[model samples]
Target: MKNRTIDYILRATWQAVSRMYNEEAIKYDASMAIAFALLSIDREGISSTLLGPNMGMEATSLTRTLKKMETKGLILKEKNPNDGRGVIIKLTPLGLEKRELSKAKVKRFNEMIRANVSDEKIRHFIEVTDVINELINNKTIFEK
Candidate 1:
C-alpha cells in the first residue's frame, strides 16, 4: 500500500512490541501473556471475573493463563466468601518476583522511549489514542 492506515500502523507496532516482550519472557520460562496476567493482578487479589475484563482477555484465555500460573506456583485461587461462586486470585511469592521483573521491563521500555521522544509528542500520541478509544467505546466510528 502506498499509504498505511492508522489501524494497520497500530496493529503492526503492537505486534512488534509483543514479539519483543515475548522474546524477553522466554528467558524466564514465561510468556508475554503470563507477564501481563501477573501485572494485572492486584496485591490484594482480583476477582476471577474482573481480571479477564481488566486485561481485555477472553474468559477461556484468561482461564488457561491462570491455570498455568497456578501450576507454576505463581498464583493461588481462593473462593470468595462473599460470593461462593466467585474466585479471587492472589499472587504467590514467585508471582510477586515475576511481577517485579515485568514492571522493570516495562519501566525500562518507557524510559528508553522517553529518552528518544519529546514529551510533547508522547502527550499527543496519548491524546490521539484516548480519542480513538473514546470513539470506539461510544460506537461513534460507524453509523448504527
Candidate 2:
C-alpha cells in the first residue's frame, strides 16, 4: 500500500541519517547536524526555541546539544539583547568549517542516492517529500 511505502521511506531515511552522523563522535546527532546545517544555510543567527520543533527535537535535547556544541567550539550561544530570556546561537569560525564539511558529506550522500535511483524516481520522491514537509509545516499532520 502507498502508506506502507511512505513508512518504509521514512524509516530508511532515518536510518541513513543516523548512520551518517552518529559516527561523528562529537555529540552530533542527525537532528543537531541538520539544525547546524540549517543555521549555516541561513548565515544569520537563530533562536534555540525556533530550532527545536522544526528539527523534531525536544527543548531539553536541543539544549544539551547546544551545550555540547558550545563546549566543542562549534557554536556560540549568547543572550539575546532584545529578549534577555532568549538565546541566539551562531556558528563560530570552527563551527562554520564543520558546517562546510557537513554540507559536503550531505552532498555526497545525495549524489549516491541519485546514482542509485533513477532521475524520474528521485524527482517523484522529492515531490512527495515536499508535500509531506508542507503538511508538517501547516500542522495538517502533526501539531507543534
Candidate 3:
C-alpha cells in the first residue's frame, strides 16, 4: 500500500488522458475544456448556474469559456424566462456541429480504452473512483 500510491496513479492517468485530448483538440483550435463545455450544454438550453458544476469548473473559468464560445458564435445566452435572474445557454447550429465532433472524439477515446482494457477492469475502476469520491464527499480521509 505504501509503495503504490493511489493519488499518483490517478494524476498520471489523468495527465496522459488530458494530453491525448489536447493533442486531438489542436486540430480544431480548441481545448479539451471547450469541447467538454460544448458537450455539457443541453440541446434545448441549460441554466448558467448549473453549467459550472456540471463541468467541474469554477464560476470565473466557466464565465470566460462561455464568453469565448459566445464570441465564436457557438452558443447563445438568453434570458431564462422562468428564472428572471438567471440565463440559459443553448447551442447554436455551429455549436451543435462542434458538440458532435467533441462527442465523436470522446467516443473514439472510450472505444480505444474498451478495446484495450477488459470490461471487468473498467467496472472495478469506476467502482473505485465512486468510492473515492464518496470518501472525499464524506470527509472521511485522514480522520481519527
Name the runs in model 2 displaced over 4 angstroms: 1-5, 24-41, 130-144
Name the runs in model 3 displaced over 4 angstroms: 1-3
Instruction: Write down the TM-score of every candidate.
Output: 0.96, 0.72, 0.94
Candidate 1 or 2, higher lDDT? 1
Query: Top TM-score: which candidate number?
Result: 1
Candidate 2 lDDT score relative to the true structure:
0.71
Error of 3 at 116 (Å): 0.7
Cα error, residue 72 of model 2, in Å, equals: 0.8
The 10-residue segment of model 3 with minimum total lDDT is: 1-10
CA lDDT, every model vs. true structure = 0.95, 0.71, 0.92
Rate residue 68 of model 2 by lDDT. Answer: 71
After TM-score superposition, what is the CA distance of residue 35 in candidate 1 from its true location, in Å? Answer: 0.5
Superposed by TM-score, candidate 3 places the C-alpha of residue 5 at a distance from the truth, in angstroms, of 1.1
Residue pairs with colliding backbones in model 2 are none
* Per-candidate total of colliding backbone pairs: 0, 0, 0
Error of 2 at 35 (Å): 7.2
Which has the better TM-score: candidate 1, or candidate 3?
1
Tens digits of lDDT, candidate 2, 12-105: 8788777656565245543545444444434577777677766667777777877777777777777988899998888888777777777766
